[model samples]
Target chain A: MMKILVVDDEPDVRTLFEQRFRREIRSGALAFSFAYSGEEALGYLHEHHSEVVLILSDINMPGMSGLELLRRVRTEPAPPPPPRVMMITAYGDETSRTQALALGADDFLTKPVDFAALKEKLLALPSA
Target chain B: MSALYNFDLLVAGPLCMLIVLALRRFFNLAERLPRWNQALSWVWVPAVLGFGITAAFRYRSTLLDDAYMLWVYAVVVLTLLLLWNYRPARLALLALAPLLLHRLVRFGLDLGNLRLLAPYASLFKGWGNFANLWLIGLVLVARSQKRLLAKEQQQRQQEEQAHQLIATQNAELERLVAERSATLTQQAASLQQALEELQLTQNQLIQAEKMASLGELTAGIAHEIQNPLNFVNNFAEVSAELLEELAEEQAKPSPDTELELELLGDLTQNLQKITQHGQRAASIVRGMLEHSRASTGERSLTDLNALCDEYLRLAYHGLRAKDKAFNATLHTDLAPVLPLVEAVSQDLGRVLLNLLTNAFYAVRQRQQQGGEPGYAPTVQVRTRRVGDEVEVQVQDNGTGIAEAVRQKIFQPFFTTKPTGEGTGLGLSLAHDIIVQGHGGDLTVASQEGRGTTFTVRLPIYSPE
Candidate 1:
C-alpha cells in the first residue's frame, strides 16, 4: 500500500482528505498519516521516512511553512530515493509557487485542492 | 615829482624792500599765496628801489641840511619795525601813525620862520609824504591777498565733506541690498522644506488609515466568512464520501440505475457550487488582508472603476459582519471608459473603504434615530476620469454633518461617533493618502440634515 503524509494547520483538512480518498483507503490501495504542522510532519518523517511515499503540505501554516518542509525533505539523508513533496497554498500565489518549485517541490496545488487531479498525480508515483 | 625824488626816497626803497621780506617771512606768504599773486610783487620791488636810489644820490646834500629830512628817515624806519606788531587792519593803522607825526613836526618848522631852513624843509616834507602813501597801498594789497586765501580753504573743506557723505550712503545701501537678498533666499528654502514635510505627513496618515481599516475588517471577515467556509468544506467532504458509497453500490448487484444516477448528479452539482462559492469567499478575505500588509510603494496600472466597485461591495459586506441587521441600498455609477492608472492600489483601496464606512455609518445613525418620514438609507459610489485625473465620490443621504463639524471632519482625532467606538483617525488618514501620497485632492460638500458627499481626485500618473 502507498503511504501518504498530509500536513496542515486546519484540523478539518484531515477529515476532508480522508473523505476524498475513502474508496482507495478502504480497498487497501493507500494509507494516510496526518500532521498539524511542519514540525509534527518532520517528527513523523524522522521515524517513518521509509514508509512515507509522498508528503502533501499547505504553504501557510502556524510554524514552519510548506516551502521549508519541502527543503528539509529534499535534503534529508534518508534511504535511497526520498519521498516526493507537493506544496499547497491558499491563494494560488505565483511567488510562492515559483519559490516552492525552486526549493525542489515536485508539484504545486491551490485550495480548495482538486482531489481528482491530485489522485491522478498520486497514482503516477513509482511506489503506487 | 623831481623835487620829491632825493636821498631820503632812495633810502625809502631799501626800507620798503625790508618790510616786504619781513612780512613774507613772518606771515608765511609763499604757502598762502595764490598762483597769480606770487609773481605780482617780484618785478615791482626791484624797479621802485632802482629809481629812488639813483635820484637820492643826486639831491643828497639839499635833503640832509633840512630838519624835515630827519623826519622822513624816521617815518620809513618806524613803519618797517611796526609791521611785525599788527595784523592786516592794525598794520594799516600803524601806516597812518607816521603821517600824523609828520604833520605835527611840520607845524613847528613853519612857526620858527627860519628863511634858510624854509626851502630845504619843503623838499623833506614832500619825501615824507610820498613814503606815507606807499606804506598805505602795501597794507591794502596784503589785506586783499589774505581774504582770497581764506575763501579757497573753505571750498576745499566743503568738497571733502561731500565725498565722505557719499561713501557712507553707498555702504548703507549695499548693506540693505545684501540683507534683503539673504532673507528672500532663506524664506524660499524654508517654504520648500515645509512642503516636503507636509507630503511626508500625508503619506503617514494614509498608512495609518490603512491599518485602522484593516483592524476593523479583520474581525468582521473572520466572523462573517468562517460559517460559510465551514458549510462549503463540510458538505464537499460528505459528498465525496457519498460518491464513494455510490460507486460501491453500483459495483453490487442490480441497482435502480436511472434514479440513483439522477440523485448522484444532483448531489455532485450542489457540492461543486458550494465549493466554488467557498473559494470565492476565501479569495475575498485574502484581498481584505492584503490591504493591511506593508506595501512596496511601487505603482502598477490598475482599473480605477473596477477597484471602486469591488471596494464598495467589500465595505458593505464588512459592515454586515459587525451589525447583522444593518442593510442599505448600494448604488454604483462606474465610468465605462476609465483608463488604467499607475497607482498604489492597496493605499487607494483603503481610502475608498474609509469613505464608504463613514457613509454607511452616517445612514445607520439616521436609521437608529428614526426621524424624518420616508427616509431611505442609501450610499452611492461613482468614478470617472476627468482629464489627467481619476475622481471617486462617496455620498450618503443620512445624518448630514453640521457646517461647523464638517470643517473639522478631516482633522486627525475628530469624530462624530461615540467614544469607545472610533479612533477618530479614519477621514484624516484618507485625506492624507489622496492628497499627499498620490498628489490628489480630497474634499467634502454637505448641507446639514440633508446629505454629505466626499470626493477624491487622484492623478493618473505619478512622476518619479
Candidate 2:
C-alpha cells in the first residue's frame, strides 16, 4: 500500500488534490492523507512515518515551510530516510524549484494542477 | 603775384597747429610739454618775434617800411582770427598790440604825424635800422620753421592711429570667422547624433509592433491547435484502455491478435507522445503569444495578485516542462487588500509574463553553470498598496545580473540567451506597455549573486 500526504495552506487546493485522487483511494490502489500546514505535516510524519510513501507539499504555508520540511526530511538519520516528496505550488518560481530540489525533493509540480499528468507520475513511482 | 604777407604765412602754421593742439594737444597747449618746449622760449612767442622781422625788413625803404608794418599787422590779425575760432574774437584782436607798438616806435623815431610817418617811417637809412631789421628777419624764419615742425608731428600721429584701428578690425574679423566655423561644426555633430538616436528608436518601435502582432497570431494558433490535440490525447488514452479490455476478454491463442495488440500499443504510445509534445508546443506558443500580444482596449478593475499567479504558473510550467529535474520553492505574499488597479488586462498580463519568464530563465542559467543541481531556485511575487499605486513585484533569488548590463536590460531585442532563443524584447515590450501604453512605472532593483526585483506601479485608475 502506498500512502500520499498532501499539504497546502489553501483548503481548496488540498481538496482539489484529494478529489482528483479520491477514486484511486476507494479502489485501494493508493491511500491519501492531508495536512494544512508544515507543522501538521511534520506531526503526521512523526506518527505515521512508516505508512507514508510519497509526500506532496505546497511551498507557501504558515508555521514552518515546504522547503524547511524537505530539508529536515533529508537530514533524518533513518535508513532510506523518508518517502519521496514532491512540492505542489500555485506559485512556481525558479528559486522555489532549485531550493526544493536541493533539499532533496524528488519532483516539483506547479498549479493549476495537471491531474492527468500527475496521476501518471504517481503510478510510475516504485513500489516499496 | 607771389607777393605774400609773412605774418599771414607764419600764422597759418600756428593757427592750424592750434586745431591739432585743441583736438589732441599737439603742443604744450595742454598742461604738460616734453624736453623741446621745456627750457626753451614759448614756441609761439619765438614765431611771433620772427614774424616781426619781416616787418623790420620793409624798413629799408620808407615807403616799404610803412606798407610792411601795416600789412604785417593785418596778416597777424587774420591768423589770430582763426586761432580764436574756439576762444573769444575780442581776445584774438589782441594781435593789434603789435600794430600799436610798431606805430609808437615809428613816431618816436621821427617826429611826424600819420602821413609823414607813413612815407619816412623809422625803417630806413641807418645801421641801427638795418640791425633791427636783420634781427626781425631771423625771428620770422625761426617761427616759421617751428610751425612746420608742429604740423609734421600732428600728421605722424594721425597715421599711427589709422594703422592701429585697421589692425584691431582685422583681428576681430578673424575671431568672428573662427567662432562661426566652430558653431557650425557643433551643430552638425548634434544633428547627426539626434538622427542616429531617432533611427534606433524607430527600429525598436517597429520591432515591438511586429512582435505584438506575431504574439497575437501565435496565441490564436496555439489555442486553435489546443482543441484538436486535446481530442487526440483523450481518444488515444481511451483507445489504449479499450484495447487492454479486449486483450483480457479474448484469452485465445491467436498470432494475428498478438500482432494486432502490438501495433495498437505502438500507435497508442506514439499518440501519447504526440499529445505530450503537442501540449508543450502549444504552451510555448501561448507563452510567446502572451508576452508579445498587446492588451485589447478593454479596461477593468484588475486584481494584480491573480494576474501574478496566472503568469507565475505559466512560467513555472514552461520551465518545468523543459527540465523535469528542476524543482524550485515558490513564495507569494499577496496583500489581500491590494487596491484594484484599473488596467488593460491583456497588457498587464504580458508584462507579468515577461518578468516571470525571465526570472525562470535567469535561474536556469545559474543551474546550467553547474553551481548547484538541486538548489531550489526561489521566486517571490508580492503585491502591495503603496501610496495611490498598486505595486506588483516579482522577485527571484537567481543569478543576479551584472551591473553593466542592468542599464541596457530593457532595450528591445537585447537578450542574454543564446542565439535563436531570446529576442530580448521581453523587458522592452514590458516597459512600453507599462510606461507608454498603460501610463504606469516599471523599475528594477538587483544585487549581483543575490537576486533581481522587478516592480510594476499601476495607478488605481489607469488613465486613458
Candidate 3:
C-alpha cells in the first residue's frame, strides 16, 4: 500500500481527502495520514520516514510554510527513493511556482485543485 | 550883489545837485553810481555852502545881507543828503517839524523883523526847493517797496509748483507699486496651483503602482480560496453518492431496513445542504478571480448590457457583505438587442465593477449622512448601443461631487473618501482599462448635493 501524508491548516481538508479517496482506501491500494500543520507533518515524517511515499501540503499556513517543509523533506536522509513533495498554494503566480520548484518541490498545485487530474498524476507514480 | 557872483553861484550850485540826483534816480544807471552816498553827501554840503556865501556877497557886498537865508538853504540840502538810504522824504519831514517849531519861536522873538528875513529867504527859493526834494524822495521809496514785493511773490510761486510736482510723482509711484503687487500675488497663486497639481500626479502614480501589485495579490487569493471550495464541493458530492449507495443497499430487503432508511435520509439532507452552500462559495470565488485576473489586452465580442447588469449585482452584494447595514436599490435599464462590443470582457467587467462599486458607495454615504425624508439611496445602471459605439452609464442619487472638484474627479488617486478607506485609484485604472486599452471614452456629469453619472463609451471596432 502507498502511504500519503496530507498537510493543511484547515481541518475540513483532511476529511475531504479521506472522503474523496475512500474507495482506494477500502481497496487497500492507498492509505492517507493527515497533519494539521507543517511542524506536525515534519514530526510524522520523523517517525515514519520510509513508509510515507508522498506528501501533499498547502503553502500558506501558520507555522512553517509548505516551502520550508519541502526544503526540510528534500534534505532529510531517508530510505532509497525519498518521498515526493507536492506544494499547494492559493496563489497561482509564476513567482510562487518558480520559488516552490527552486526549493525542491516535485509538483506545484493551485487552490480548487483538480482532483481528477491529481488522481491520474498520483496513480502514475512508480510503486512505493 | 555882483552880477558874476549872482549868475554863476546862484544857478551853478542847484544845477550840480539836480544833475547828481537825476543820475541816481532815472535812466537805469543807478547800478553805475557809487555806493558812497554818505561821502557824496559831505562833498555836496561844502560846495553848496561856499556857493551860498558867494551868492550872499553878490546880493549885498557890504555887511553880510541874506547870509542867514543862504545858511538855512545849505543846511536843508545837507540834511537831505545825509539821510540818502533811509528814505530821505521821512527824514526831511522829521526835520521840517523841528524847523517849523524854531521858526514859530523866532517869529515870537522878532515879529517886526519877519518882513526883512522873508526877503533874504526869497533869494534862496526856500519852501519851493524843499517841496521838490520831498516829492522825489517819496517816488524812490515807492519803487523800492514794489521791487521787494515782486521778488517775494515769484519765490512763493516757485515753491508751490515744486510741491505740486512732487505730489503728482508720489501718486504715480503708488499706482505702479499697487499694480506690481497685484501681479506678483497672481503669479504666486498660479505657482501654488501648479505645485499642488504636481503633488497630485505623484500620488496617482504611486496609487497606480499599488493597484498593479494588488492585482497580482488578488490572483493569489483567488487560487487559494478556490482549492478549499473545490474540495468542499467535491467532498459533499462524494458523500451524497456514498449515501445513495447505502440507500440502495438498505432497500435490498435487509434486516432493520426501516431504521437504516431514516438515518440515511437525514444524512442525505445534510449532504445536500453542504453541496448547495459549497457551490455558492465557489461562485463567489470565481467572481473574484474574474476581477483579479491579469489584463491580456485581448478583444472579444461581448454582450455589454448583460455584462453590466451582472457586475452591478455582484458589486452591490459585495458591498453588502462588507457592510451589513448598507442598503440601496439598484435600477438597471439595459437595452435589449444591444450589439456586442469588441473588447476584453474581463477588463470590461472590472470597469463595470469599479463604476458600480463607486455608485453604491456614493448612495451608501448619503444614507449614512441621514438624507432627506423619502430620499431613497439608489444606483442606476444603463447600457445602450448608438451608431458604432456601445455606452454604459452608472449613476448614483447620493452625495454628488462639488463643482470645484468636478474636473479633478477623473484624475488618478483623486478620491474624496477618507484615508485607509480608499486608495483613490479605482477610477484612474478603470479609465486606463476602458479608454487607453480599449480605445474608448469615459466621462462624468454631476451636480453637487444632487447626483452623479459616469458614462463609458466603447467603440464597436477597437482601432487597435
Candidate 4:
C-alpha cells in the first residue's frame, strides 16, 4: 500500500482526505497519516520516515511554513530515499510556486483542491 | 528883540520836526500816518521861515503872531493823532504834550495883556526850554522801550511756532503707531487662521490613515474568506458525490443495508461540514463589513473577551498575508466571566486591533533580526475584570521601546516604523479612542531588549 502523510493546520483536512481515499484504503492500495502543523509533520517523519512515501502540506500555517518544512525535509538525514513533498497554498501566487519549486517541492496545489486530479496524480506514482 | 524871536522859531520848529521823525522811525508809525498829519508836520517849516523873515525885517506884524499860534495848535493835533494810531508812541506823545501846554500858556498871557506879569513871562520862557529838554529825554526813553517791546513780541512768536511744530510731530507719531498696531493685529489674525487650517488638514490625514489601514486588512480578509469558501465548496461537492453513491446503492435490486447506512451517514457529515463552513464564511464577511463601515458613534454592550480574540486573529492573519514567512505563538488568557462593556464597538475594535498589530509587528521585527539563539517570538493577550474596571493587556516578547521614544509615543505623528509603512496615527488615535472617547486609560510598560506591554483599562459602567 502507498502511505501518504497530509499536513494542514485545519483538523477537517483529515476527515476530507480519509473520505476521499476510502475506496483506495478498502482496496488495500493506499494508507494515510495526518499531521496538524509543519512541526508535527516533522515529528511524525522522524519516527515513520520509511513508511511515508509522500507528504502533502499546506503552505500557510501557524508555527512553520510549508516551504520551510520542504527545505528541512530535503536537507535532513533520512533513510535511503526521502519522501516526495507537494505544497498546497490558498494564495497560489507565482512567487510562492517558484519558491516552493526551488526548495525541492515535488508538486504545487491551490486551495479547494480537485480530488479527482489529486487521485489521478497519486495513481500515476510508482507503487511500493 | 528879533534875535529872541528867531532863536525861538529855530529851536521850536526844529524840536517839533525831530519829534515827528522820532515817532515815525522808532515806533514805525510812518506807514499809518494820514496825509493830513504829514502835511501838518511840513507846516512847521513854513512857520519857521516866515518868523525868520519877519524878524530880519524887524516887522512886528500881528499876522505873524497869529501864524505862530496856529502852528502851536497843529503840533497839539499831530501829537494826539500819533497817540491814537500807535500805542508804543504814547510816551513820546506825552513829552510833546508838555511843550504844547507851555506854548499855550505863553500865548494866553500875551492875549490877556498882562504887562504886570512881564517878569513871569521870562520865567515861563525858562519853563518852556526845560519842557523841551524833558521831551527830548522822554522821547529817547520811549524809543528804547519800543525796541524792547519789539524783541519781546518776536520771542513770543518764535515760541508759538515751536509749540505748533511739536504738536504736529506728536500727531504724526500717534498716527504711525496706530497704523503699525493695525498691521500687527491683521498678521495675528492670519496666523490664527493658518493654524486652524493646519488642524483641519491633520484631521483629514488621520481619516485617510484609517481608510488605508482598512485597505491593508483587505488582503487578510480575502485570505480568511477564501479558506472557508474552499471548505464549503469541497464539502458541497463531496456531499453531492456521497448522495450519488447512496442513490446508486438504493437503485440496486438487492443493495447491502450496512453499506447503504454508511453512505447515508457520510452524506450527513458532509452536509454538516458544508453548513458549518458556509456559516464560518458568513461570519468572517460580517466582521469585515462591520470593521470597514463608517462609525455611527453609537454605544452598545460588548463582550471584551470575544472582541480581543477577534482582533488578535485578524491582526495575526493580516501580517501573515503581507509577510508569508512571519509567525508567532499567540497566547490568550481571557477572563471566563467578564461583564459586558458599554462601548462604541467600532472605535473600541480599532483600538484593540492597533494594539495587537503593534505587538505582532514588534515580534516580527525581533524575529527578523535573529538576535538571540533559540528565541521564540511570543505575544500574549490578557483580559481581566479588576473590580469596577475591565483591563485588556497586549504583551510581546520582542524588541522593547526606548524610554525617550516611549514618552512621545502617544503624540501625533510620532512613529518608529519606516516611511510609507506607517501613518504614525495608529497609537495616537488608539490612545484618543480609549482615553478621550471612552473615558478610559491606556498605559505602556517596557524594558529595552526585554519586551513591551500595553494595557487598556475601561470602567465597567461608563461615567458619562
Candidate with the greatest TM-score versus the true structure: 4
Q: Put down candidate 2 lDDT per residue, B349-443, tens digits, no spaces.
A: 77787788778777767766775645657888999989888889999888888888999999977878787666677788789989987788999
Global Cα lDDT for candidate 1: 0.71
User: How much native contact recovery, as a fraction, does model 4 achieve?
Assistant: 0.41
Candidate 4 local lDDT, B1-464, one digit each (tens):
65445455555566667755754566554555566456656746766787778677775554355446557556655555656655556776677777778766666656775543678867787888999898889877877787777788788888888888888988998999999999999999999999999999997888787777776667777877787788888877777777787888889999989988998888889888888888877877776777777777888898989888877777888988788778777789999999899998888888888888888889888889985878777889999999899999999998999999999999988899999888889999999999998899999999988899999999997557
- What is the RMSD, in Å, between candidate 2 and the native fold over all Cα? 14.1
Candidate 4 lDDT over residue span A1-128, tens digit each = 89999999889988788788778887978899999888899999998868899999988776677887899999998996788898886655677788889999999778769899999999999974
Model 3 clash pairs are A90-B224, A111-B227, A112-B226, A112-B227, B1-B58
* Residue-wise C-alpha lDDT for candidate 2, range A43-116, written one tens digit per residue: 88888856789999877543366877787777866445468899965444677788787778889887545668
Please state every model's RMSD to the true fold in angstroms.
16.9, 14.1, 18.5, 5.4
Q: After superposition, how far is residue B458 of candidate 1 from its true place, in Å?
A: 13
Estimate candidate 4's alpha-carbon lDDT, on a 0 to 1 scale. Answer: 0.81
Which numbered prediction scores highest in lDDT against the true structure? 4
Clashes found in each candidate (C-alpha, N, C closer than 3 A): 2, 26, 5, 0
Q: After superposition, how far is residue B440 of candidate 4 from its true place, in Å?
A: 1.8
DockQ, 0 to 1 scale, candidate 2: 0.05
TM-score of each: 0.44, 0.43, 0.44, 0.79
DockQ of each candidate, alpha-carbon based: 0.05, 0.05, 0.10, 0.54
Docking class of 3: incorrect
Tens digit of per-residue lDDT, candidate 3, span B1-464: 35435344444445546654653453222343355443434434544565576665655222122333344444545544544554433444454544444454444435444443577556334554564555466546645654664567688788888888888888899899999999999999999999999889866665554464344335334434455466566766666766766767677766466645654664565476567557655655665565556656777888887677657656665565455445566677989778878888878887787787778788878878884766677889888887888889999997888888877776877888887666667788788888788889999898877889999998887447
Off by over 4 Å in 1: A1-128, B1-143, B206-216, B220-228, B256-267, B282-309, B317-355, B367-397, B401-447, B450-464
Candidates ranked by lDDT: 4, 1, 3, 2
The CA lDDT at B205 in model 2 is 64
- The reply for model 2, stretches above 4 Å from the true place, is A1-31, A35-47, A53-128, B1-294, B372-374, B462-464
